[model samples]
Target: MSWMSVDIGENRWLSVSYYCLRQGVSSGFRMRNWELQGCNDGLSWQMLCKHERDLSFGEQAHGVAGWAVENATAYRHFRILQTGKNSDAVHTGVLACAGIELYGALTLACCGRCAALVEIDGRALGSAAMLEGARAGEGVRGCSRALRRSGGGTRAAAEKALEAKGRREQREREVR
Candidate 1:
């Protein structure tokens, strides 16, 4: 089996609940059984999810194929391990992906007090004064709006973070 991993750039916590995989220009390639794992130290790992059936783009040349979890797990690193593939008799054992999207909330614990200092496109959105006066929910909403106004990838990231936060809150309520 071949595998590839992505280091989320930091050891911060993230509640990754959704993933989208887009196929590259090559249409013939497809993945069979695969596993998605998460870890904090990169050495000790835990399986987050697995797919036994085949995952493919089918007739679509470039499209998104994704999945979402009811309960998200917090981790700092993630990996994709491909155990099998669907191909002709002569298999070169090469798997390629055009792009992958991970959606989740960046945990407040990861941000600490500095979360209020987050910046987007060189502009500071979560100023100390704003965070001090903002309510819990209001702060999140404000940040989301600021990120959207800033535009580009920052907005997307903020959206995911808020989604994850919402999901986490929901789960906690259920538990209580």
Candidate 2:
């Protein structure tokens, strides 16, 4: 059986709470007796669900076949393998797929991996480069809001940060 796989990546991999798929445009290319599989190492596959020979997709070209996936583990890779041939007179595993969609939220590992800027009682955290106002601890790298004062509102703070970013870029260009 032939198969195709997609890598969601470890940084923001999906948990696949639910999934929907559409069949190919042509009736002869719709999926028949196909299996949806998942994998972590990409070599060894684990079957999540098996779909029997169904003609619903062939009936409606743009028809959608959806399933509620109940999986505890979030995989980095997902694959669909053609297990059996269709009702075509000259049977061949040359079917086509319109599209496949996997819906899920980001895992815990992806959280707290991005920079955040917050303010409390006029004191801002994550912007130690705001020397014009007041800075204390270390600043966050690649923080767009890393150079703003409290006197200025959020818009003014963003403008100030942009100005600082431009100056840093200019310095980098000069060094190059």
Candidate 3:
């Protein structure tokens, strides 16, 4: 009846994991039967994984479920549909645990362009030329290396800015 949907940004994930609320015999509200579905348009859904009614997490502490989408087709939209509830929760809806962690490698890659220029390891790296010089998919690490390539002057400036910002924060804290 109820479902939790996810938009995998502009990239696709090789696999996904779901973390539930609780587990064990007392898990009346815990999701028992569910289906992991995928769709590119969000209108038509295709089944990815089907979990039948069972208390499989006998010793699994975290109530975690995961699977790799072996179809190899890149889907942008994904949903975990609760098909059936526990006998104790027969009158209720929703079958699987909701997503707590969203893992996407591309999300980090997408932000590398701007995040690198912002700061890294408490140092401020304000360099437009460095970012422009770097290629896509290099991510934060590549952008950082680009900053280093820009020479010691830029790196030194970033260090000073970080130090200055720290001093400013300490001063504000004392005032407060």
Candidate 4:
């Protein structure tokens, strides 16, 4: 029903924990689950984790925990989702909340002498320098690397760019 920032770190990973309880034994559990969402700005949050019950056991604690998405855009806020509540419910009880925490670090890659950039395409697109120095010509909209072919191709040196499409087309024409 409510959300708050629990903690922070200079790093990129985030961890958060919280506790809740029913108004009374007969009133029943007012909240059934918890969720973790993320956002670039503090405005919109995409659901990272969802619909989880209390992680603790036999402790009679309504505490659910979730982790922030790795490499998620910096989050300025967090939220809680609540369900299963009614006004006349005799089983209702006030839930006490406490001990919330969050932590994270920057996401990066270092492999030997070569480093990979996160959120950038072509790093894992097969051979290095294959798609290097390639560019899409003007008026050309965009190229989808998802359809890129790799290995044993005639255009092996071609990077996944709009320009590569032009080169591949020219090669096909020459072959004909």
lDDT of each: 0.58, 0.60, 0.50, 0.37
All candidates' TM-scores?
0.60, 0.59, 0.47, 0.34
Those runs of model 3 whose alpha carbons end farther than 4 Å from true positions after fitting are 11-26, 59-62, 100-176
User: Each model's RMSD to truth, in Å?
Assistant: 11.1, 12.7, 11.8, 15.1
Lowest summed lDDT window (length 10), candidate 1? 143-152
Model 1 C-alpha RMSD to native: 11.1
- Tens-digit per-residue lDDT, 121-146, candidate 1: 45444544334444343343233222
lDDT measured at residue 21 in model 2 versus the true structure, 0 to 100? 79
TM-score, cand. 2 vs. native: 0.59
Write the candidate numbers in order of decreasing lDDT: 2, 1, 3, 4
lDDT of 4 at 67: 45
Higher-TM-score candidate of 3 and 4: 3
Clash-forming residue pairs, model 1? 105-161
- Whose lDDT is greatest here? 2
Candidate 4 residue lDDT tens string, 55-129:
332234443433434443444455554333322245332333444444442221222332221122343332222
User: Which of the predicted structures, 1 or 3, would earn the higher TM-score when compared with the native?
Assistant: 1
| Residue 124's lDDT in candidate 1 | 44
lDDT tens digits by residue: candidate 3, 1-176: 87878785553332333323334334455656777777878899888668777565544434654444445444568777778774354546734353434332121122244333544455445434333333232212334322321222334544554556567779999999
Shift in Å, residue 77, candidate 3: 0.8
Measured by TM-score, the strongest candidate is 1
- Scored by lDDT, model 2 comes in at 0.60
